[model samples]
Target: MKKILFLILCFPWFGMAQGDGLSSTVDSLYREDQFYVGVTYNLLSNQPKSLSQNGFSLGFNLGFIRDMPINKRRNVSIGLGIGYATNSFNQNLLITKDGAGGYTYSILNDSQTFTKNKFSNQVVEVPLEFRWRTSTPTDYAFWRIYTGLRVGYVFHNTVKYSGNQGDIKLINVSDFNKFQYGLTLSVGYNTWNLHLNYNLNALFNDQANIDGIPIDMNTLKLGLMFFIL
Candidate 1:
């Protein structure tokens, strides 16, 4: 009779131990770091009326995201990442320095219209997001919505213009904004997400003028993001 009692107690304990181990394994697999790469179509906003966009400009981003769980269920997390991004603008306006040491924008004349006229900048960026997903350890595909802010510093700037008149390449343009901050969002399912960003700051400082109007252009981007775990 004692043996029968011992067997009953031991079986329950063994089952409980197996259940705990399975739970731990699921948690470990579910809560791993996520990495992402994205491509964007950049659009310049608040631009001068005379300055028209020629074609679709591009931006690229890559980063590793650390997810911090705040709830017991672990479906929601705070994501923080450090990333690098580069943005290009293709437009009809030319940026140049005026005699007073301020930057000036002029409408490109026919002679100045070249095969390629673009301004681009590279930045080191930090992103913070409140992330929510319907994800589980056994399921790798899920729906997600992540909204966040990004802060960046422009480390490099370049202007390239090629035409019949000549080819002009300028590095580290003085008028470009050095510090930039923006709002960002991503929403979708599985590995693909629709991403959007709108810069909160002007692309140039007060020292930049377009036809005596202070140039206050901002940047807007729409793109696709791919997440990899």
Candidate 2:
């Protein structure tokens, strides 16, 4: 009877030991690729119809992502990452300070068509995604779709204008929004993917006025993304 009881007690421990060993083996076989870099072409949308998009706006991003497996299949994960991004806008905008110490925006006159005009911003962003991929441990090429949200804080901003008259550069311009949030989407196969972002917040604060009208603009970005495993 004592031997029988001993076996009963030892069986559960043996089963548990086997279960732990299998779990560890599965963990050793799991593959996680956690770094990616991307570049985007930014399109300024919702602008005051008066402001025209004159040239291509470019942006670049680099990030480190942590993937948390949510199921036994290891094909679905929650991804969290932090990254640095910068964007430049090429447009013709006339910004001037009024007597009341307020700033105003207007379209550049035909005679003053600037030789170069652009606004640029640098930001740090955090992104969270619900990711799905059809991948196996041995497969390096797979289809994936990642949808998420991103929040960013602008750390630097500047406007540059160069014309026949002269050159003007302003740093940390007033009325520029410091905080922004957006929706992010990435979908594709293998090393290259299609990425898109739609910003939900206005580009400028309510205090930014043009001809007594408040300026409200948003951004849209679309480009190719590359991943390294």
Candidate 3:
């Protein structure tokens, strides 16, 4: 009768010890000192009618977060990162020639009429996000998702005109308002993640005037992310 009573008293204590050990291991393994680097691909999904040609932009980022407890098996984190992105586009042009006989001839050229009219831009961005995990926030083979906002600025914009190859359109931009605002969504398993993002800001600043034509830019991005810790 005494042995039975002792075993019952020790059972809860043994279970509690095991649970504490697991929690301590998780806490140590997923400390704030770790870091991650990942890649992103973005596509221009929304744009004004004037800007018909859009392309895929590729980018990369490195980040770190301090984990905060939410539950025994899950946690949340605040993460920050910086990234670089570049996308290029070649637009088609219709050409018309005046004949010697005072008649007009139009040529529908499938070829890129502007051999040099292609345009490209590079952007630098900062991301602030919240990450949540189904298992320990930093554990392997766990399901996770992060949704956040991003602010990006265009550092470089260059357009090569088809009619004039040597004279590239130089756009001098200075202002944070010219920067883009967007939402970022991601899903991951273990160390691998996939992302989709949409830009909420217009491509061209309100004051931007190109040949008296203003353009809006928006993009959709699909990419894979590899987490580093």
Candidate 4:
């Protein structure tokens, strides 16, 4: 009788151990790349003939993305994110206000000397992405390529100038376009990724001009992107 009872208890314990082993090995489905941060070298694009970039334009970006997998393999997905960005562009263009509540736009000639001339904007941005990766539920490192569009609303803008005209600072000077949109691409493996952004619209509105020429300047940014779960 004791031998039969011991066998019955041993069988139950063996079954329990087997169940635990299977549970530990089977991988569960998971989400990846829900948060991200980046830094970029901002470049002025579609510039006028006399206009040239005087200093390096730089920008920082940080955001969160909602990762949604479409395929059964979970390798193809869509991402939507919201983020904040601040950018600065340094150039020779000058902006000043007129007596009639209007604004004046000018490009400094070589004869004109200025210590500082630049403009900056802070924006709230949204990003939509189509993402593809070689990632599985069990893998921690994988290759990914993501392409997307980003739209931004400029909440604050400023222009600063210091030179022969003395120090002049203007706030929300009325020429910058409050709405901005751009195309974005990110590609890499593991934690390091290369990111690119190109703005499709001009940075300023129609009122900004230099000697009857429209200063329809846009921006291009190239940088690195770091993603985290």
Candidate 5:
């Protein structure tokens, strides 16, 4: 996991350095009226009830500028995109019992007790965001900062657990569906954009308490992008 995160953070610097030369060529091409397409690698935001448990995610986007200029330097753009994201956690590590418990289990040479109702949920979603640029084609070598809002739907939300006597069960919360909505904020340079997103709805519609405590998850995401076109 550490290695995965290390690469996610470092990969951009590597690409940024290499893009310096390519930016010149890209600039010439876009001046004649063209489109841009790219893929973004997003780092899920770590927040309560967030869908970003997976730590790493990717998205694809494409858009066209209207040839109108902004600040006499940058151009305005609108685009459509779809993304897939998920959040997951290890149950055994978070669950616990008071030894006057229902079940006993061993994880990584450690013994722990847990109540029967042990479950965790991960959500997979897709969002569409509207993008606008704030930089010009000539001033900065190749950079633009953009921001927008996105709407997302949760396609899958489920929980997994092992009952007493080692009986495993996976529960599908039917109430949880591909129906979800959210907003996104991002800033990009030329072909790369950094993003942050938050889900506006609660994970559980029933308002049911989790472990005698309420669990309300608002998703968060951090991502990096690269133009593909």
Candidate 6:
């Protein structure tokens, strides 16, 4: 029969369609993978009595998070990420290279004529977060709150001073604390989120001092965070 032959010929296509649908469903049920980027206003805190910030300080970071859902509906999960960040602080704490192959620290006066004085850090960072979201596997737009800890190692540093002292660039600041750790919180809707970081440790080691008083400055960042799948 022609009708029976037609049904037989179509069976393979029908099975193929069903197979594709099943595959898509499985992929949709277990996805929380995202890439994120952020820009921040960096602030220094716990400063020495004479040190003060002068200009704008900035920071940026980007990374990917591996999301693992723990609940059946997939709204709760944990994320671990590795990223890179460059943080800069513009302040009056001045650092100059001493002739003995070390560094000297001082607080600049308000009347000092300097075009720029700042220190920047290049860091390799890791973040671990506990995430709660109003998102389902199939939803693309939702609200989320992620709180976590971020730890980093400062691999490189630079200090620049120009003005009364002329142009001076100092690198490999030996007195800097190479290890940095902080608390992070990010919360918001679909595309825009507010992010904050409060660092718990000093920016420099105990050996970095001003007139025998240790410099115990820390950093706080406030900014926007964006995520993409």
Kindly list the per-residue Cα lDDT of model 2 for residues 58-156, writing each as its tens digit.
888767778887888889989898888889889877666667976778877678867888889999999898889997765556889999999999999
In candidate 1 the C-alpha lDDT for residue 204 amounts to 89
lDDT of 4 by residue, 72-135 (tens): 9999999998999889899998889889998898888998899899999999999999999998
TM-scores, all models, native as reference: 0.84, 0.84, 0.61, 0.87, 0.51, 0.86
Task: State each model's CA lDDT, in order.
Answer: 0.80, 0.79, 0.53, 0.85, 0.43, 0.83
**Model 1: runs farther than 4 Å from truth?**
1-25, 98-102
Cα distance off (Å), candidate 1, residue 182: 0.7
Highest lDDT: which candidate? 4
Number of colliding residue pairs in model 1: 0
Q: Which RMSD does model 3 reach against the true structure? A: 15.5
Q: After superposing candidate 2, which stretches have Cα over 4 Å from the reference?
A: 1-31, 99-101
What's model 5's overall lDDT? 0.43
lDDT of 6 by residue, 1-229 (tens): 3653364345445434533454345454565536777778999888888788878898888788888888888889999989999888988888987789877899899788799999999999999999999986556568899999999999999998898878888887999999999999999886668899999999999988988988988999999877766
Q: Candidate 6 has what TM-score? A: 0.86
> Model 4: runs farther than 4 Å from truth?
1-27
Task: Show the colliding residue pairs in model 2.
Answer: none
lDDT head-to-head 1 vs 4, winner: 4
Task: Candidate 4: give the clashing pairs.
Answer: none
Q: Which digits, one per residue and each the tens of the lDDT, describe model 3 over residues 147-205?
A: 88878877886544545323445343331134777898778765556776678876655
| Candidate 2 lDDT trough over 10 residues, lowest sum | 19-28
How many backbone clashes can be found in candidate 4? 0
Clashing pairs in 5: 37-228, 38-228, 42-223, 43-222, 49-217, 73-136, 74-135, 74-136, 154-178
Q: Order of candidates by lDDT, top first?
A: 4, 6, 1, 2, 3, 5
For residues 138-197, what per-residue lDDT tens digits would candidate 1 score against the true structure?
555678999999999999999887876488777888888899999999998866678998
